[model samples]
Target: MKRIGVIMHGITGRMGYNQHLVRSVLAIRDQGGVVLKSGERVMLDPILVGRNGAKIEEIAKKHNVARWTTDIDAALANPDDTLFFDAGTTQMRGSLLEKAIKAGKNVYCEKPISDTMEEALAIARLAESAGIKHGVVQDKLFLPGLRKLAMLRDSGFFGKILSVRGEFGYWVFEGDWQPAQRPSWNYRLKDGGGIILDMLCHWRYVLDNLFGPVKSVSCLGATHIPERFDEQGKAYKADADDAAYATFELEGGAIAHINSSWAVRVRRDDLVTFQVDGTHGSAVAGLTK
Candidate 1:
């Protein structure tokens, strides 16, 4: 059996723990393993790494993960581990991925690799210079509805597709009555929080891959909610844009618009909805089904 040792960083965080660790890695482990086209079976062996060893150990024990550690440097130094994954605080993500790239380990992380476009570009350049494999998460383009849309495009269902539009957002509760469903960092600007910074990146890939190459963009963003309570029950100023209104011009002359917010109440199964307008016909897709 070919064992692929993966060092999983920040698996103790909400998105990291549940989405990456439990739902993805552990679920894959629950199945036998992945088989390559070359007829070799590849098994995932994930070592959980985090600053909080107790929390890591708790999650590891709960999920039956074989190993847990707080030492990231040591974990990266291990030659047995070939891949390094991070789904952590966005502010620190650039440095963490840089370390992995320098270590010659294949690197993967959550989107916007860095808050600034310059820093993000620098990381990509460094990774290229280091000659290591690196990728950012772009799961939105791989959704079932989007895949169906791709099939439609392949079959010429769009027939000179005119435009694409998307609506995405939901009211994130302040930790006043109900605990906020989203991570607290999403509301703070310094922490790499903001709807525009977060959602536009996803839409860039979604539009580029599904619609066409986005040649230019016109965007306006806002900080709708001025203050919000954090995980610690303290109010903080939300300098980040809680909402975004943006337009894109694709390479093929198709225009795309997407409005993303965290202030609206979801009523139309309306967490995320995408609409494509074509000369022949039009279709709409939502979160699921």
Candidate 2:
């Protein structure tokens, strides 16, 4: 068996804890690891790292994870860890990836790699220079519905694809009468929060991979809710955009329009949906079905 040490950062958060750690890594471990093409068994040994020692310890104990720590430097310094994964706040993603790359660890991180294009490019350049494998998480493309869509596209189901329309997001409680579903920082511009920055990244890949390469874009963003309660039930100004309407011109003359908003009510089949129209036929894809 080949053992791969993965340094998991920010697993305390909702997405990190539920999606990455529990559903992905632990699930892989439970299934007796991964079997390679050569029938070699590859097991992942994850060391959870986070800011809160007590919370991380609790999670580790509950999950039966043997290693947990708050010291990022020490975790990065450990030569045993060959891969570094981050699902932390966007504000810190670039710097964290840079640190991991410099430490000679391969990196896999969540989207919006950096708040700015300059920093994102710099980190990409540095990772290339260091010769480390690196990737940003693009989970949407792997969804069953999207996979089906990809198959249909490949089979020429949508001949002469004309346009693609995507609708994503749901109403997040404002945390007054009901607690907000998303973290408050997502509404603060200073904390690298904005619907455009977050959802556009997903749309970019979706259009490029499923439709065609995007040539240009026109976007309009809005802060639908001006104020929202925080985790502590304290009211805070939401300076970041909570919604976005973007239109992209794809390379092959296919037009793509996406409306992403946290304030919208869901009357559709799913929380997110994409409908593609073509000369031959049309199809709709959502999170499922």
Candidate 3:
């Protein structure tokens, strides 16, 4: 069995709680664990480390994990050869991963790996130089719909993909009558959050892997709702782009368009959907009723 220790932070956040804490680590553990091909079980022993003690204690109790700490430095110094898993806020990611790499830990980080392309490349370079295994979460490609797309591609159902289009968005409630579902930091540019950065990272993988490598891209973004009310009923100015419209020229000559937004209302069940057209056939896929 691989006795793996993980250093986790931002466990209190939505993405961190659901994706990292629950889906990747805890949910796997609940399934009696991940088994390797060599019959060696790769077990994850995540030591919950975050800034908030109360929330960490609660999460620890819920997950039935004993080890918990607010001290990241202490955890990094722990004896176990650990994998540093970061689901922290985008702005905090670069330095955190740098520290983890310096501590001789393999890194698995959420995307967009850093706020800027430069920062992302630097982290990638650092991890490479350290000889540490590093992975950026490209979760969308693993989704059922996308998997189906992969199947179609492999089977050559769509002969010579000519063009592609994607529509993704929903009208996020004003958070006035109801508290905003998304993090307030998400709408702030300084916090390394915005529609384009949050979404296009996913598209980069989807396009590159499924369709073709992106040759060039042209994008336009705008903030539709400038003022949103916080949970405390305070009005806050949103600095981040709420929507993005982008066109991509793929290396193999296929063209694609994508629209990502937080302002449009979802009348249909599928908030994210796409259409792929080719010489032989066409397919429309998304969250269906």
Model 3 spans > 4 angstroms off: 287-289
The per-residue C-alpha lDDT of model 3 at residue 171 equals 69
lDDT of 1 by residue, 31-71 (tens): 97888899988889999999988888988898888888999
Per-residue lDDT of 167 in model 1: 93
Better of 2 and 3 by TM-score: 2
TM per candidate comes to 0.96, 0.98, 0.96
lDDT of 2 at 188: 95
Per-candidate Cα RMSD to the true structure, in Å, reads: 1.3, 0.9, 1.4
Specify the highest-lDDT model's number: 2
Between prediction 1 and prediction 2, which has the larger lDDT? 2
Question: Judged by TM-score, which candidate is best?
Answer: 2
Among all windows of 10 consecutive residues in model 3, the one with the lowest summed lDDT is 280-289
After best superposition, candidate 3 residue 147: deviation in angstroms?
1.0
Under the 3 Å rule for N, CA and C atoms, how many clashes does model 3 have?
A: 1
> Which pairs clash in model 3?
171-264
lDDT of 1: 0.87
Positional deviation of residue 265's Cα in model 3 after best superposition, in angstroms:
1.0
